[model samples]
Target: MTALPGPVSPPPRLLMGPGPISAYPSVLRAMSSELVGQYDPFMTATMTETQELYRQVWGTANEATLLVDGTSRAGIEAALISLIRPGDRVLVPVFGRFGHLLAEIAERALGEVHTIEVPWGQVFPVSAIEEAVVRVKPHLLALVQGDTSTTMLQPLEDIGALCARHGVLFYSDATASLGGNPFEADAWGLDAATAGLQKCLSGPSGSAPVTLSERAVEVIGGRRRIEAGIREEGDEDAPDFIRSNYFDLGMILDYWGPRRLNHHTEATSMLYGARECARLMLIEGRDAVMARHRLHGEAMLAGVQGLGLVVFGDVAHKMTNVVAVEIPEGVDGDAARSAMLADFGIEIGTSFGPLHGRVWRIGTMGYNARKDAVLTTLACLEAVLRRHGASVPSGGGVDAALDVYAGAGA
Candidate 1:
């Protein structure tokens, strides 16, 4: 093989896809700050600060909050594996592909899984989950707050009350909804909630932020273990071992606890990035950042409609970041997307699982959730469609989006 080139560089482009929305400049700058070893005092302090930032973002006072050293799925695994023992029952209310993923992971953790699926493009009512819980009497009730696969937001406000009344631990994967939608961890009675920075947080996707309520913490601690490496020979009997070594929430908590036991080497750059992402949102105020995403999403929806594309999903229940658009006939979805990236330097996404080839998912999230980014994406999309033999009114989509932005005046 030929020797590698001196240095590799990447072509920069506007990211307007379903996830990995463009990161804020501050987030990037934070990642470039000086690096330190995992146990270094400054590094550990930074980790503490990062946890505090996410706690504010999550609107929770739970003391077991910390970042998983992997993506959103890592957080999900940690929550499931630590809480779900063999033969324990878990009830999953599925609305999209990621819901299936939750069930799969819980099953691997040896849960006796039960599922009730709403239609692909719809979410269940609180009564539905409550009814299922009553019938199934499961130990845990798991769902996703917003499933980007369908571009639909699952309403959790009332579900929490039902779970609390029924005595089932509530868990949710808020990977796609955390910042774009209003989420209150404690108020909603969420026992465990996890998310990644790739979506509305506007950071790289490596680290996952997670929090657990006191009740959930008690359940997880039931299976905790004293690490042999640190335990004295005469110490009290060790706590029961968690199912998976790597996903042991107890061990992770210890690493982030007062004792500072060693876990995986945290992703330092990602920690910096995640910290700054939360910092920026905190500075903007959570409600304001959510409003910005909402306005941009409305403008994008209007622009897509002006371009003669049909918007998908239940409009009233959709999230403020991603929009699902119906693909028109006689045009190749993959080809148009490739053209958008290659010619216009804009990235859009197609659906996953069942919705594949039937819809195009365009997102206005995080740092890209702005008027300029929204209008530019609309303009480029119009150009790509026209060049690819689809009909479009000249300056139609862009002008429509501009009108919305102009009216909103931000």
Candidate 2:
């Protein structure tokens, strides 16, 4: 056996990249609190409080709001697998990489997946999605609210109404956009929505918060199957059992609901972090947190432009948390990113798929969405660009960002 090094002490990094962004200190502290039994009064009370807090964050009255025990994709899979039966037609509008991921997960669930596409850096219009829905006549419309890969925020306001008009169940993956952008689950008529704590919620990427409307709950509940070990006498399983037991939302609902059926032991520390994330967002006011993201995100955007770098995608429809910029001519994108990390102790991200190697994605989100973080990143980026023989105006980046902050009265 190879002997490993002693106790772990990692290098400190200012994570200014797409995600997972730096988590709030309060969230970290919450995770270190004392543990309790799953059904202990304190534990159950904390769970209930977390649900209520997320209700405010999602802007919904969904009684089914709770956290999934894994990463953001776990929530996505749970929602999709439980909602989509075999041979059901699911329509996905692909604008970015995550859209493709949604379609793939649906296919694995035995849903007949149909997809409509736009370019990587653009989003689908309501009319385009409506046109596809009319043609495909799908049972569910699975879409992404914000895809960090493209830095585009698909406008969901009218899409839900259009789906309702056509009898299509609406679901969205809001993992990258939730707290940093405006999302109204009930008002928007979303049957199901899922998000994670890593992005704008300022926590580690372990737990996924999910909310389901009454209709969505009804569909999933119809497939409920009590685990054999926990099944009581006379309990019956559905004819079409959910293929993946861990991702079964029906059984998960029973566990989270008043019945408190045992499915798996709740991840207690992650639950604490998730609860703290929602609590901090609610304490600050959801709109206020989103406005902060916008303020800092705009600063980062203006700063990059001042450095003579072109921004990617349609600016008007971009999310308020992250921005992608074209890699400068005569500069090695990877080398510059490496220097930014190795020398400056800061981190930024490179894009994927079509945008890969051509663009760098920087984020102003979560606890790092602040004037200092934005300005510091721009300052380091300017140094890296200049060292790489790219011509950049002296103090231009910081100046432009300051101008934005000044305009915002920050």
Candidate 3:
């Protein structure tokens, strides 16, 4: 066997890809701070502080707000498995791949899932969803707010109110949109919402912060914790049964509640990162952060178009942070992406479903949502495309991006 290297350093890549966006320097510093016992005074205080920080990020007053010690998918799983019963019907609007993941998780938790779908790269109309809710009369309705797979952002304003009128418990996964797009969990009538720190949150991808409404809490309360060793002695107040232990939201709530029961060991470093992510957003103010994302994202979009690549999607309904560009004929999209990463140390993404080879997804999110980052990405991308024999309009992409940046400042 060949001898392996002891350690390695990673190449610096500008992550203009789908997620795990460039991490904040301050967030990394917070993660590197000295560790303490999970329940230590300082640790607990920080944990409580993290919760408060997320409350502002989520714009909700729900008492069940807390972090799942895993990725954004963990938060989605917790919400789905907890709310879904053995035979309950769940309505999921399948607009993109992530929406299908929600239905899959709910089905795994024994939910009878019904789906209403549109073509990929498109969102379902509110009337379509309302029709499904009226037909299925589901116990819960799940949607993905911004799907990176298709670079489509669903309009939630009217859909949330429609769900309320239908008496359906509404939930959304805002992983791709939170912080970079407009989201008001409480005001939006969201029953439960979950998001990861990977996207516009500008943190590492371990912790998933979530919030749930009072009605969501009540729906979850019907099921409580089921202890392993104490199976013989069932509680008189307990429901018939509970689902998987690791994904149990009831036990998680209690642990995060006043009782503070022990669940999984809290990921200390990740908690620090999550807290800093929200703290920075709050310090900058949400509107200002959103504006920054908007400006940078638009610059990147303009730069890509200036490079002669056609933009994808209904431009009017596109999200602020990520843009999809159509792959030019005779150019291998994967080759361009590989050269960008291997040669230039810049990463972009490809689309999903019907758009697998048709478009590339580029993002300007979080720490990378800036003038320099946008210019750098465009410059590097232009070089990569030129190397593949594509005629790059000289100085076009970078010039357009710079113009957008300067105009925004002016």
Q: Pick the candidate with the highest lDDT.
A: 2
lDDT of 2 by residue, 1-410 (tens): 99988997879999999899899998999999999999999998898999999999999999999999999999999999989877789999999999999999999988999999999888888889989999999999999999999999999999889989999999999999999999999999999999999999989999999999999997776545332333444544323547888999888888889999999999999999999999999889998999999999999999999999999999999999999999988899999999999999999999999998999999999999999999999999999999999999999999999999999998
List lDDT for all candidates, in order: 0.89, 0.93, 0.88
List candidate 1 stretches off by more than 4 Å. Answer: 225-241
Model 1 error, position 108 (Å): 0.5
Candidate 2 structure lDDT: 0.93
Candidate with more favorable, higher lDDT: 1 or 3: 1
The per-prediction tally of clashing pairs is 0, 0, 0
lDDT of 2 at 295: 93
- Candidate ordering by TM-score (highest first): 2, 1, 3
Clashes by residue pair, model 1: none
Evaluate residue 214 in candidate 1 and report its C-alpha lDDT on the 0 to 100 scale: 92
